[model samples]
Target: MFRRLEEGDPAVRTLWSQLVEISLQEMFGIFDRLGGVTLDYPKDGEAFYQPYLGEVIAEAKEQGVARQSDGALIIEVPGEETPLLLLKSNGTTTYATRDLAQVRYRAQTFHPAKILYCVANEQALHFRQYHAAARRLGFVPDSLELVHVKFGLMRGAEGKLSTRRGTSIFLQDVMDEAVRRAREVVEAKNPELSDREKTEIAEVVGIGALKYFDLSHDRRHDIVFDWDRMLSLKGDSAPYLQYSYVRAVQILAKVGTVNFPLDKWKGESGRFGVGLPEDVQRLVRELARFPLVLERAAADYTPHTIAQYLNDLAGQFSQFYECYPVLKAEGEDRAIRLAIVAGVANVLRRGLDLLGIKVLERM
Candidate 1:
């Protein structure tokens, strides 16, 4: 395929163009479903860099960074054992060569301070080699940050999924199943809800559950995908967070903002904090950490940090809920409880949004 493309076969070009267009459409469709993902950033595929492949190979050879080894062009990056292949024996460009071209193109065009590859952990070696080669070839300056944001895979009961072996589970299928299961929960828990409400809420809960399960884990460790675990309402899942958020919404709604005046208690968190308002300490403390959590998560590139913080915040709210009686309490006490609920609802909604999970007013 690469050889035919490099040779400029008319038939191959037509088919390749059609395939790339279709594949991109399909890929963007999946990204839409995943949420919190966007392709607005400048990007170019292998086809865009194909024309420069030979130029890159020639330059590599001229710079003495690449050599013909076993009838192929390879770059043996210093301190790395596995050499990066620039061309196959057929003189067709490799993925590494295309990537190197992209590096050069972006470096000259955008002058970006950093280039990050959010690829699977298995490609660690490839990034190391290509990045080293890019630097050696002077494609990028030494100060330009080339980062590999590696994350673990989702394993099934059989073990790690493999697309080559046809053992990979379709993400759409998993999503559909989660939504179906979420619908069932909605029906059982709130049968009186409208049909439209049920469907919308299920989608929010189901997709949220899946996202939460993945993001809640430490990015470096692998996670086992289980329907029960992913959708659990009482556990550290998206549904649990969503449910807690909705529960707070429900409490606020039941009291009716007019009756309790949530606005009156606003900004009174300091007055109602810790020992001042009694048992509200945990929730107040967690709520206070929201800003710091955002800063830390951004600095570390760890979404799970937000996930874990939301999880703990939800748990603290759960404890506060059991200990305090929002609806039963009167006057100052009731307003304080409602204020805490309001604070939790806000943070949970915002934090979940940060993770690309949708929120529901009630579910």
Candidate 2:
């Protein structure tokens, strides 16, 4: 089929174009369902770079970065026993040809400081070779950073989920189940909420729970997919943080504190009251660390850093809430405690947003 398409067969080209259109549309729908971004760029599929394979090979050969190994065109990376194969012995292009073409195209077109590839750990060695090849071929400058952000698999009861093993879980199936379970929990918690409200809240909680379950774990470690633990309101999950945010928001609402600006208590111009209780002080300190946590998370591209910090912050807030009285306190004590709770809610909302999780006003 690919050969027919390459041969300029009209029927094959029409069918291939139709398939690409359908696939892109389906991908957009899925991203919408997940409440994720639909990138604002033209599609750059393999077909777009298919014509560049010859140029990529010719340039690599011209630069002496690529050589033939028993009739297979390959690039030798230092310290690696296996060379990167661009073309097989049968004169057919391998994935390395397409990927290297992509790297070259993106580097020239986008001029990005770093091109990060978020892929499974299995491609680690492939990336190492291609990155070296890109540098050696002068396709990209030494200043251009190529980062391979490798992550582990989504494991199930049968180990790593795979279509061949009949253990693969479709993403839509998981998302639908998450929302269904979330709806049930919502009904149990707040039966008074209208169906529309429950559904809206469920979507937020369900997607947030699913994203957090994966994001909370280290990217290097495989996570056991379990819904019970993921949506547990009191456990280390997105629902836990969402519920905690709702609790804080409810307190502020009950106290008629509609606008609790975090800037009043954060940054260099921030001020605080004297002689706050130990628990309140601890909560304040945790809130203050949000900036540092965000910095580390961004710099390392490790979302677990933010997730872990949010978990710790929620725990400290829980401790403070149980031991203090926000609605019943007086004067300076009441003001400071409300500020702390508001800060907690704010950070939870922001942190969860960073993790692509949404917080609920009520859960």
Candidate 3:
């Protein structure tokens, strides 16, 4: 699964994916050197490295540092013919041996500013030892940035998702289930609505709920999946933000002819400033912080930061909408307030979208 992520567009989900790929590649090399796995994976505890691992062993041999014997690939250590076995005396390769090859390849080729190995928290010791082996082999750089990004696991109510027991809840399944539940809720709330309308609304509510639930927590913390919490119409769930967007839309429907003027607002400073009441002042502040929030999220690789920002923005807009009357206000204040609300609604929805959440125009 981790290896599959390396070949995708960069996203929050892919960061950990590449890290796991690198780690597993190294482990495969080590396993190859040891006696290869005789047991099957996840059953008898037998593990084997990914295929095409011979390339690394072949490269080592060409460099006059390794030899192949009895179907095993071995590399010379500092003092002895005691080869770092890459493959088992049997034909199979091991996880550790494959990983050794991966490290060797990266040091020689990638030369990255940093090679971050994102793994689970428990593998810290394994990473340290892996780096130590590299240093000993005179293949690793002292100045190379070798980082391990670790995190806790997500658990369901039953327990940690277990593929072994066929109990692991897939991400796709979670998304679909959320949508199904949202549809149910919408049907209950608005029985007069058509099925098509309910489905459209449910798509936004469901996807929003899933993304918000996953991102609201810090990555270092283990998450326990709760259907009720994730699908809640209140609290910090996606549905709350969606409902907030819906409220903004309702207000806009009441006030006609609101223009965004995004292009005009750009490259000019202080010219577009409009007077705002205290209630709307808070909303404007939240809207203006959109770019800053996005920058922070991208810089820290934290999607949750963006999620939290949108939630706060939504709350602020909800308050402003309730307290101020956009359509009933006199003179320019009405137009300005409408514009501000519309702009804020756009920003909030966009931010939520980046987090893979959806926005609903109506509850």
Candidate 4:
């Protein structure tokens, strides 16, 4: 639901609006996700919060985003207001309070053992407060964990995502740009490819590259957006992975065989009998590492690790492609090399999927 809101879906807007008189603090509860800007609390005493009703109000007033003096917390999160609701007289209830209520409800209703909040790094303190409040409210206590899986903001070439000037770039726009850039590269590289082929390929390569770039960096560190870096055809980019996959498919197509004794090859005594190309063995080892890579990335809520893993796998497969001749080889050796390439292709496809990028069957 929060993701839907972030995406600006009208349905999510309607759903959030249907809530009872909501407070400034309650927005977080209904938001389901946090990011970018946040409310600020006082530095010292309660009097500082007194003027704002509570610390939540003080933060909103300081930020000049909202204030609530009526309704439940009086802000009514769903409705429209000039300058928005920043504070209310309740002194105890606010957006944060509402967030606690929602959290409590979720904890009791769903009884999820754990909750992962995907939010921006800038809102670390806000999320921390949310979790702390949940604990204080005896919502989930210590058993049901609440995690703020935060990531840095996405900036355009200009620096920082702007909302006031109507300069904030939507995620959809970013995705579209990536696809457009990728399509250009594809046309430039292969003039013979049809428009449909180029378009489909571009969608995968372009989106994959951008997603990889975003995931390649540590989530805590801010990323400076670069069109060249995110859309490059060469180096460690999405096209590179796509190219590797294309090459693998081409090799298999040319070889004209998919039959491999995969089960037997692993356990057969002949496994050690044949000298598999060093490069093939290395590629196979890399392919086998995908599950571990994905597991770690998902556990940490860091997609960059997955991107890095995909990049490394692609590089290894490319090297294997260059060093060995799958079509030229024969017997168990050929079978083994083809198997390695097949494994690489599968892992690459799956890894890209996890990053929310498409995988093209051909370049």
Candidate 5:
């Protein structure tokens, strides 16, 4: 991809590179604000991997696994009636050939237990053919797993967003629009806040709202982008979670110097003589399950599970906050309730961090 881009006309390539850099800068800025980190590109791997393309194709042809279909080179994969084309009739390489070489290079270099390709569902057959061809050519071992983690499309209001149709929205525009709408909401809700505070809050809310909306949905299902729904505070949205976090912070602030004795609440039934409220217990139980939720999400390679869990945790904490009065309660009761509130805040912050969403101290 980089080679093709670099091989284009100098003026066109420079313009394209500038546009890509601008998009990347905007994207990275948003990510940084949301407490996310960026990864470094593997620059040295290009030299090592580039030579495998021709080698793999030559081996395929030499082994009789790749044959000529008309003027194009093709491989007949098992369980599929149609042959996978490796090269065009014009003697140009196809994506399948490049993919087969890439996969073989990865397997030889990394020897990883599993190689997961997170791609759209539309390219399912392409990956299948690549995997099958690589195995048949002895480039990939049978023991090494090559899995495709297919995701669904993200559509706009009218239909699938396409650049050719001129309906494709740029990342900068989306971020700007979200922040702009968020500023309006913040201004209306908290008119007394200073400009700087409002701007900061708007940024956090806007970016968080956008990220939560994406991560909350099942990856295999198509999601429609709706501004009103994404920025909403009522339903299972980022604003709702932020509001819950703020409520917890407010409760903690009311009880000035109260200490949360986590040691006292080590077990399900703590030393507190009074029985805890059901809502408080529910919040505690949900907080306890965060580790399991994190593990499951990592195993399945789905951040939506973590997003869903955080939303549920936020809802549980909201109910507990509404039902119980922490500052007004006496002695052990107050301590227990404060501990629960602290736990909720901690879990909520950590969960949001996992989803690359920022938390607002005040919203």
Candidate 6:
């Protein structure tokens, strides 16, 4: 005889909970090590909404939005030829049923003004139908904003990474490989450092590279997983930005503590009156644009905007560093240049942090 699946079934429930816990722990551990901000998983919607499925179906039917078609409960969605199936002939609820229930539950529980769903581009139609059905059934308010943030596929050199095709790369393996490769580079460049320092630097650089590569691209564009491009110090990669930050830190260290006179530098044009060099002026202008860039990134839901800004800022700083003298300069010129360096370092740190990439003091 078959047994009913219930929470009281200790044998199945305990094992399933343990499995989910273990997987979440592993994923969170890797993310934490990579300097990513921690996030809590939402409550188990599947279990919480199962009992209320009948109620949702009944409501849909009462509202004349859902009807039986070919042994399935379907809701006719606008602008679509096919109706959204809520329940199959076998009495099993579909994903639409769960999602509709989730929308209602969230609306009642949180009363959020907007909800964003980040899923693959392939699920565009499904979400459109789901949102339409939710609105038609009065589960979601007409004013409630629903955004679908669709991202493209991440493919390997062979093609799209798939578990069934045996081309999938595990997160742990990717992290380990990144660290291993980074360690090799670190040992070659900074062999004089202690083993511990090398290991720490490797971890920072490796994880930063991975994050930078992912965040530096437009989400809708498909990306190829490339190691050389990601780990390189010469291009618009994490190492390049880290190197720039380290250079700025080194300059600040040599110049001692800088006390920039805010009132003296203030002017009607917002430009410093310290007779700043053109390159220094350029760097300052770029630094000032950080806030606007961050705003745009948030509005667009694009981390790549920040990535591009950091890359440009780093490039400008590089130019300024090569063109000017910070340590040996005297009086106002030195102070102004040092202040610019400090600003660049601060902006770089903040930008990289927003992108979930770690910065290194010395690299």
Q: Compose the digit string of candidate 2's lDDT tens values, residues 136-241.
A: 8888988888999889999996688999988889988899999999999999999999999999999998988899999999997788899899999886999899
Superposed on all Cα atoms, model 5 deviates from the true structure by an RMSD in Å of 3.7
Off by over 4 Å in 1: 41-44, 254-274, 277-279
Across residues 288-345, which tens digit of lDDT does each residue of candidate 3 receive? 6678888887666677788788777777776777777777888876767778778877
Task: Write one digit per residue (lDDT tens) for candidate 1, span 1-363.
Answer: 768877989998899889877988878887888787866653436677877877898899999889989999899988887889988898777789989999999999989998878888888999999998999999999879999988999998878988987888887888898999999999999999999999999988898888888888888778888889888888689989998988899988886663323334335455325344545655676677789999998877789999999989888889888888889999977777887888888899999999999888888
Q: For candidate 1, which ten residues in a row score worst on lDDT?
A: 258-267
TM-score of 1: 0.91
- Stretches > 4 Å off in candidate 3: 1-52, 58-91, 95-119, 122-149, 164-167, 253-275
Instruction: Using lDDT as the measure, name the better of candidate 2 and candidate 5.
Output: 2
- Count residue pairs with overlapping backbones in model 2: 0
Best first by lDDT, ranked: 2, 6, 1, 5, 3, 4
lDDT of 4 by residue, 162-204 (tens): 8997888766577778888888888888889988888877776
**Candidate 5 global CA lDDT score:** 0.80
Using TM-score as the measure, the top candidate is 2
Report backbone clashes per prediction.
0, 0, 26, 16, 0, 0
* TM-scores, one per candidate: 0.91, 0.93, 0.66, 0.70, 0.86, 0.92
Residue 356 shift from truth in candidate 3, angstroms: 1.8
Which 10-residue span in candidate 3 carries the lowest summed lDDT?
42-51
The 0-to-1 C-alpha lDDT of every candidate, in the order given, reads: 0.84, 0.85, 0.68, 0.65, 0.80, 0.85
Model 2 pairs whose backbones collide: none
Model 4 TM-score (2 dp): 0.70
- Location of the lowest summed lDDT over 10 successive residues in candidate 2: 265-274
Cα lDDT for residue 354, candidate 2:
87
